[model samples]
Target chain A: MARKLYELAHSRAGDKGDVLMLSLIPYEEEMYEKLREQVTADRVKSHLNHIVKGDVIRYEMPNISALQFVCQGALLGGVTTSLGMDTHGKTLSYALLEMEVDL
Target chain B: MLRIGSGAGFSGDRIEPAIELAEKGKLDYLVLECLAERTIALAQKRKKADVMLGYDPLLEKRIRSLLPALLKNNVRLVTNMGAANPIGGAQKIIEIAEELGLKVKVAAVTGDDVLPYVFENADSLLFNPELFETASILSANAYMGVSEIVPALETGADVIITGRVADPSLFLAPMIHHFGWSVDDYDLMAKGTVIGHLLECAGQLTGGYFADPKKKDVNGLAYLGFPLAEVQSDGSALLTKVPGTGGTLTLRTVKEQLLYEVMDPSSYITPDVVADFTTVSLREDREDRILLTGGRGKERPAQLKVSVGYDAGFIGEGEITYAGENAYGRAELAGAIVKERISRNYDEFKVDYIGAISGHRGSFGHQVNPYEVRLRVAGKTFEEDKAQRIGEEVEALYTNGPAGGGGARKFVNEVIGIVSTMVPRTVINAAIKVMEVGQNGKETV
Candidate 1:
């Protein structure tokens, strides 16, 4: 079965400098492995290539059953220096949730 | 057993919610973390102009509305609203107490300014390296911890004001002051830091910022309640809100906030301790209570995070809208015209035809042309007049543009922003002073 990432997980975003961090936690503990296999830096980078200009780094948190994505050079130049409205890139976590996963 | 309430998370947070927390939350400590990365720098700018304006703008409003209740509840207040000038902020609060005819003690924490040290190490701290020789910094302050704050809390100060302390430290100081927790106890410090981190954002931890509609459903968010940490002596915290308030307390919301702004789960750096978010686990102890456990901490970092504020010049933006037949074409033409006119004034400018490919970062042209579109031109320049010129060039498109170009608007605003860097702990030498209300309903420093 195929489902949207939002269907399997919920996420939140925070920022440091121009870098944005997104945490994706699964709805169920069982879904963590599926997310681990399906979600990768490449997929996330490609999925958000529309806005993310820099590299995307993904860290696995098996203990918490979550994935943290650190997207660099994403805020046009970062919040203080950026002209973009989504300065903190709070909306990007939802954009990551929009990703689809095959279960 | 100590209960700390989060009155505010950031500078512009809603004030009424804090009033509710002060009146009904039954809190021992009400901590408001208002200063952000760049707020102090901006506050310094305000202070340079007027001695009275450097603190948080809502300092009086927050005090006027919540002070009486806060005093009635015996819930001492602590906040970094002191921003760039804690002394001025404390004086303002003392004046408020006088005007209200209420007696309360206030404390102002100082010595975080490191501008002199920044100048000494200017070559190393420049974000652009080129700024080492050329740019003069506007403000520089080190992120302080609980060293000065705990003593102030011990002085029985009803209100504690600080400048540039770590956000969680605002909450952690009360914990240490009341519980007699040793500052060197990394495990307890980490646990307390976890509590501070959770409640620092105020509403974000309690589902106000975690709602996703279908995926996550929050109730009555219009009046979302702030967070409260019921912390035990053993370093365990049960997070809840003033029951009967808006918002949800789910495992999901707790989990999101648990990792908010964390660089590494194993090592979340702060001035106080290198908190380990990985060790902590969340469990729903009840409908509205989430228990946080297993938090451990390591030694504190050697370098405290320093926020460097410098002038980023002025940002001038102009926008125009287009509709009807050939709207996309007309908008694109308008963008081209503005770009040609504005680029000559500055070396660079951004032109976004904000409907077809604006969101895509203009990487690929959209096959489906939008029925209506907006043309926006924006850029940063050292001169305010040059930034203003960017908008004027766009307005020129009204007469020089294709059919149906309308809604032309432009404005310019100066930008004050912080650059990321670090400094040694010796640079900040944080100090604390207590100010109180005299018997004549006047302030005594």
Candidate 2:
């Protein structure tokens, strides 16, 4: 079944310069493997293509059942120069959660 | 076990939660981690304008409100609220102590500023050449380590203030001081570094950023409690908050904070050690306590990271609202008019339908014919006069049709851009000075 990523996981976003770092952690321990196999860097890059202008790199943390994505060219110019209302891109996590994943 | 409580996460954090921690948390040390990346740079600009005014603006108010509780509980304080001026900040604390009829000792740590070194070596430094060539440099500060802070803690001072130090270093100093851990001990350094990173954001581990309606709910958010760590000699700690407070301290909250802002899971670099978070383990102790242990570490870096702040330009922003039937269409019209009018003078511009397209850039799709919407137009320009035109055109929409435009507002802000470079550790020096005040209002240096 096709389901929203938010139904199975929760995420948080942090920023440094023009790069955006987002962490994805599953709600259940058993779901970690499914998220790892299904949610790849290319999938996320294509999903948020409208928002992120550059490449996305994913790092795995099996001990904590979490994944971290470092997306470049994400913030328009960064906090000091970005014209967006949420200059820090704190809302980018919710936007990542809005993606649809095959479950 | 040594108990340490987080007073304030940033410069302008809530005051009452810190007071609650001081009054009831039974803490041995209270560390307030302020000073963001560009904060010291902004403070340096102010110091250039006037010598004694570069410290945190709320230092007096914060010290005045928490002094009684801190003194009564016999808890020592450590902070980077000194910003660009640690000596000035330390003097202000002494003055406040005398006024409140209390005796206190304050230690100030200096030598984080490396502007002179940066200027001498700017040609060899690794940074954006274009920015370095055109922009005027404002400030450059190297992140100091626990080596300087431990001496201040050793002075037996009631309060310790510094200009720019690593956020995690603030928490690790007390652990190193109390436990007498050697800096070369990488295992202990990693464990202490993880604990510091988890608690550095203050209320974050206690549910400040972990609330969602109908999905993951948190109770009593109005009186959210800040976090404290109970550390043992073996480099293990219990993360919890004061009882009867408004937040939760479960394994879930701890796990969320464990990876917050962390780029690499295995290697998180600080001035003291390169911490490995993958080895850490967490378990729920009781209702509101979580036991944390086992974060490994490697050797420290030979070079220090420096934050460089410079003038970018100005941001001119304007917003106006349109309501009552076909609001989206009318808002779009207003956005087009402003963009067309200002495109000649401004090269870079941003137009957003605030209620619908601002945050996600219309990725989530828009509402079906919303009753009201706000239109925002902004531009980047070097001249303040040119920036002012963006808002002027937005406000002119009142009489120029697009119908029902109201609540027009505009702003122009000077922007400061930040970049980073590396400097050899030996290029910087750390110094500490202590100031004391007596009960009779007599000041001694």
Q: Estimate each model's TM-score.
A: 0.94, 0.97
Residues B1-445 of candidate 1 have per-residue lDDT tens digits of: 8999998989999997788889889999998889888898889999999987799887888889888998888999999999889989999999998888888899899988999999788877765767434345889998889886888887788999999888989888888888899989999899999999999999998878877677578888988999898999988989999988998887888888887887677888888899888788888899879988888999988888888988877888899999979998888788887776667776347777777665445433227578899888888777889999888888888787778888899989877767878887888877777888857665465
Candidate 1 TM-score to native: 0.94
Kindly list the interface RMSD, in angstroms, of each predicted candidate in the order they appear.
2.6, 1.3
User: Once superposed on the true structure, which residue ranges of model 1 sit more than 4 Å away at CA?
Assistant: B132-134, B324-326, B353-371, B443-445
Per-residue lDDT for A23 in model 1? Answer: 95
True contacts kept of 1: 0.45
What clash count goes with each model? 0, 0
What residue pairs are clashing in model 1? none
Which candidate number maximizes TM-score?
2
